[model samples]
Target: MTRHARSERLLLCDELDRLGPDRPTLCEGWQTRDLAAHLLVRENRPDLSVGRFVPFLGGHLDREQRRIANGDYAAVVDRVRRGAPAWNPMSNAKVDEITNLIEFFVHHEDVRRAQAGWAPRELAPQLEGKLWSALRRSARLMFRKAPTGIVLIADGRGRYAAKLPDAHGTVVLRAPVGELVLYAYGRKGVARVGFEGDADDIAALQGAELGIS
Candidate 1:
């Protein structure tokens, strides 16, 4: 089986190199260099990455991220390209795939969509299936805070009830799996997904804070 996580990592690295460090990315306030440093911290520094979920440690994570971002830009990008080191749990192929697939895919789009003249890429069906499978496993938790019912349709893949019906009813989002993933990841402004349902419900879903932090 092909490993899309690895491929996305390399592609993101190439974009980082081509665009140089100062390029903008869809991650608000994060440039290419910062994004690269983020990937490195996520893969290599489990101790600090906890700050991503534990709010109190955020300052430490932020300081380390800035330190890495301020260093050699080329070196930072190269480290991301090289992926997690032997000591990092993400170094295992299966673990990396299970964890980094969506992480890299979202971040890759984060970098691409923030640029000028960028377009969504056509993804392989296998990769789309993998993403859909992953979505199926996590949609509820990801959409738990949605103020309205949520449904995601991945064209040929299938439909998923991302959130249970709420008083506002359900809103459906239609897109290719990759785009749906982007939308679910809270790249709402950049994600090329179409919405349908009662206008109010759709609006509520749109305004709702989404994605895991």
Candidate 2:
């Protein structure tokens, strides 16, 4: 049902290889090499993965990630292409599909959209549906601090209330499902979604910090 996860992972690895280690990505300060190393740590070092969500261990994670990124860039990409190692729970096909589908797709776009002249890819209907479902599951957390009410609207894909209305009211973000996913992931600088609502509320939403770390 979620085979797109594997395809997206492979595609991201290909782009990492093609673009080389120094290319920029939409991930704040992370270059391609840094992103690849983060992926490796995410899948292979469960101990370090906690650092991503735990403020105290952030330094340790950063140090370890830098250690990995400083190595042979080609070797890093090759390891990512091989997928999670057998010892990692992510190596289980079902677990990988459930967890990595959104992770890989968003990171793929992180690399793609950072490049000049890049445009959104037309995702298959099945992939779109899966992304929409994933968004539904995580929308509230992603939009938790949004200044206004939040609704995501994708034509022919239905709408979801990511956050209920605040005093300023709701803002509707209209775009393809994939774009919505990107926006929810803090790729606001590159996501092509449009907004509908009170001008002030929309503006407030635009300025608000959105997405998970």
Candidate 3:
């Protein structure tokens, strides 16, 4: 697990290095270096005092996200927020670790796909569990939109299987574990995955409303 985290950080660092200082990235309006700076800030800023980190009241993170999603990522954020020496900073939020893990994992792909147009990076084997847990949960969240369930079959080398929580049938997706994992998160296109169940549901997951395309 530790190694996976370290490897993940290294991969992101490599992508950032490759992007250099003046290239536009997949993330809108933010340059590649700008994304790197944002990541560095997120990882390093975990040590701030409560007052500095969490705001008491306002529009909330959702509102903040809306503002930033269509606004300037660089203008509002400081690129290099220094953090205490703890390797990586963490949050006290209930789901902080899991949420950040997914954020980093998906965005790592986002950064790579957006800028270099490269294949997904190789992830640690342990990531299979975290990925399964995450995708399973996210599947439930996305289930309401579909009449059936989707079964995601990874390389099966990892602990994950072509799991379908509750549905009429199963849909199978197989590839290199890393690529399959990304595909399950709806990070990769539906065509990249081999489907084995309801075509409509599969198409829904791959639909424009879901935003994987």
C-alpha lDDT score of every prediction, in listed order: 0.90, 0.91, 0.50
Expressed as tens digits, the lDDT of each residue in 1-213 for candidate 3 is 243433454565565555555666555666655565555445553332232346763235334334343444343223222221344434333344455556566656766776544665555567866666666656545434433454555665543333353434445555655555555555554225565656765565555233222
Question: How accurate locally is residue 174 in candidate 2, as Cα lDDT from 0 to 100?
Answer: 95
Q: Give the poorly placed runs of model 3, Cα more than 4 Å off.
A: 40-99, 120-124, 127-130, 142-147, 157-170, 211-213
Q: Rate residue 73 of model 1 by lDDT.
A: 95
lDDT of 3 at 205: 51
Clashing pairs for model 3 are none
lDDT of 1 at 159: 92
Candidate 1: 10-residue stretch with minimal lDDT: 161-170
Q: lDDT of candidate 2?
A: 0.91
**Predicted candidate 2 versus true structure: per-residue lDDT over 63-116, tens digit per residue:** 999999999999988988889999988888888888999999999999999999
Once model 3 is optimally superposed onto the true structure by TM-score, how far is the C-alpha of residue 75 displaced, in angstroms? 15
Better of 2 and 3 by TM-score: 2
The TM-scores, one per candidate, come to 0.96, 0.96, 0.57
